[model samples]
Target: MTTVPPEAERLLENEPVMAHFATCADGRPHAAPVWFRYEDDTVEIVTTGRKLENVRENPKVALSIQADDGGDTQWMVTLLGTATIVEDEAETDEARRRINEKYGAPSDAYEENELVRIDVGTASYRTY
Candidate 1:
């Protein structure tokens, strides 16, 4: 069993912001901002909007969690993973709870929308 490095674990456990998710389409990348929570070896995010379309068309996804600054020096973690849809209510609810805990509870606006999730398959990190 591989253990998460101390630096990696610390960065994730105390991350200040959510990263953008990019999915490949026709050799190009579609990017969007998303909030995420880490569980075990995976990073999960909520998006019942745009992500639903991107992930459906291409399951291959790359997600990044990093400091929200335009400067060249920033801490970033990039993940290469297969984004599988979580259609199960329980699973979705669990994801909701985790997300709410991290970013605050979901708005009533989310209730009106359909939300699907993406699970990070493999993660890599870089701090500059």
Candidate 2:
């Protein structure tokens, strides 16, 4: 497994930005801002239905976790990665906790639903 650098890790951990994950279908790219978690250089995000459907249609995707700032944006990481859908209860629970610590609590009341894990296949960074 490839390890993320400190800069990349920080940009991921505390940038306080939502990731816009893009999935393409029928020559169209669908983007969604989502909360995610990072563990040992691997990033994981949770989604219920739509994202799953998109992933099912296209396993390859591009992601960008943009930093929130006006002039001179803080940073942005964008690259390609192979997405694998993971449907493990224990893993989802862990994802819940990690996501909470990073972003915030889930919008809906807690209930175990069909959760998925997006493991970063290959991650790279770009600065402007």
Estimate TM-scores for all models: 0.77, 0.79
Error of 2 at 48 (Å): 2.1
Error of 2 at 39 (Å): 2.7
lDDT of each: 0.68, 0.69
Off by more than 4 A, model 1: 1-6, 68-72, 106-109, 112-121
lDDT computed for candidate 2: 0.69
lDDT of 2 at 43: 65
- lDDT string for model 1 (27-60, tens) is 6898888777765556677676666777888888
Report the Cα RMSD per candidate.
2.9, 2.7
Clashing pairs in 2: none
